[model samples]
Target chain A: MANILTQNDIQHVDYKDIDLLKQFVNPHGRVMSRKRTALTAKQQRAVEAAVKRARFMGLLPFIQK
Target chain B: MEMETNLSEEGGVSRVYEIGYLIVPTVAEDSLDKVVGEIRSSIEKAGGSFIAEGAPSLMRLAYDMTAREGDKNVDYDRGYFGWLKFEASPESAIALEESLRTNASVLRHIVFRTVREDTRAKIKAPTLREVKTPRTTLAAPRREEEVSAPVSEVDLDKALEDLTTE
Candidate 1:
């Protein structure tokens, strides 16, 4: 299947939006299972990578410490 | 298992540092090189290697810092955000913090520790590299014009004259 995230989709997502992150991740800090999210493995990985980058840049909260 | 534990704990892998600093805006633009050099030398002296430096990003302070002896009444710092990832002893890290704190040029600073292993492994394990879109010729000139604007050297004399006239 064609990956759900196109280049434009990734470009529009700044790796900083909290709601976009929540769509791919759970409050428990785990990536949402691909079956539930309906994302191909590649798109899933991309979402996970973007979330990590967002957390690193202080744009997203990874875990409550 | 004990041997593995000892090896893992020996140096415990180096901690990565991400440091940011704010300096006085009135400082001459040309002097940034000297200031950054001084900071790098200090980090190196404490056994750290500088990794990455970012372009200065202008920022506003969350709160005003009260002026004391030499400080002006208003704290207006133009942030020159730099990122340095280095390996150093914990003692050296403490010294680095102290040096940044004492420097008159630096208005504020913070050091965050991160893991290099994750970053390193991500880099080493190659994935499909996307080819960048070819730059259109028409777009290149616009970018160059924007870059070539002598923003740093514009109208200093006129600005000073304006101040005097006022």
Candidate 2:
């Protein structure tokens, strides 16, 4: 799939946006790699940080069994 | 005044921080304002100035989370979520976090350094590209069989010439 953030012109990823962040996570609740997501290094870092923050706030699950 | 002097003596530099929190679902809706007011007052007490905030709203949690209450742990499937952006000295920020940690009404919280400008993503619709199909024949469209057939050397050269001229 094409880069969703690049396609939508999204520069910064907000941790509160769990709906959008969920797309980058796998069934196990693990973050997808840059290769799998086809995102730039900067974009990948932003997504990683946002996901971690969301997990801390219980907005996203850390592990999905 | 005393706190300001102490901070200045330590050469403390104020930095922007955003705190996101989850309030225990047990809190009555009518008393939600009182809880929010407590947080705002704490920020002011810490010499922090508010930049922006999202009022607490009830929301379902992604998974069941347990927080200690008295001697027992209570599982929660929902909570009031909210966030606030402010500027405060690093020392005061840490102190503010400590205070929140002891508040029984707070289920979870996170504070991190951030910029004053809004950095949240604004998703937009993807723009579609128009594709142009080249017409191989001017007369009746070439049959599907002919379309897949190999082009002659003459046609290849003509196509190259057309591309270069364009």
Candidate 3:
């Protein structure tokens, strides 16, 4: 199945956009990969980078309690 | 984890980096600016020039950070979050990280090589200062007394009070 990001025709994922990235992050604050999220390989890579950047900026946590 | 280098418009060797750093929330808004200034100065000393993305915003931490103060454990619940994009060489990146690590006001910081964009930043390195002192303005540089003195809590109180009065 095509992921929602692609279905909606979103081009590049933004690391600073926390609201959009939150959907792909698991409860534990980890970004889900293509296997679980069904994102295209390219999109998955973008999401991965976005999530990591968000974590470092404290928009998201390394681990959630 | 991988370092990618590219030529720039100025024909100087420079690489872009994404820097994310956290400041402890206990610092007053006045002192916070000082902390940021110090960090930026260190970055300049290490040959990195800051590219302003935006102003940093205060944020709540996702997990509790408990640390031992004098006797009781203090929880760092909130922090000032900032993101910066800068251009520098690989060696300067190391120096930048080291400076951030030593500063107590910085609770956390991370630096990584970001994918380069088309915009080019001029590459120039600042001279190394022999005396390590907390810097202020350019005029007169600093006072003789302040050069050897450390940042005292009384100064912090004065700065914090300024926030309320004005």
User: Candidate 1, residues A13-59: lDDT per residue as tens digits?
Assistant: 32424455655667765667777666656667767766766554344
lDDT of each: 0.56, 0.83, 0.71
lDDT tens digits by residue: candidate 2, A1-65 = 66878877776678987767887899889999888888888889889999999998888999999
Query: Where does candidate 2 stray beyond 4 Å?
Result: B1-11, B124-166
Name the top DockQ candidate: 2
lDDT ranking from best candidate downward: 2, 3, 1
Q: Write the per-residue lDDT of candidate 1 for residues B37-117, one digit (tens) a residue.
A: 777888999767666655555544333443243754655523454456666666677888999878877655667564443
lDDT score for residue B106 of model 3: 79
**What DockQ number belongs to candidate 1?**
0.06
In candidate 1, which residue ranges exceed 4 Å CA deviation? A1-65, B1-13, B57-72, B117-166
lDDT of model 3 at position B33: 75
- Model 2 chain B: which ten-residue window has the lowest total lDDT? B1-10
lDDT of 3 by residue, B30-50 (tens): 777788888788778876777
Per-residue accuracy of model 2 over B10-50 as CA lDDT, tens digit each: 47777788899899999999998988898888999988889
Quote fnat for model 3.
0.17
- The CAPRI-style docking tier of model 3 reads incorrect
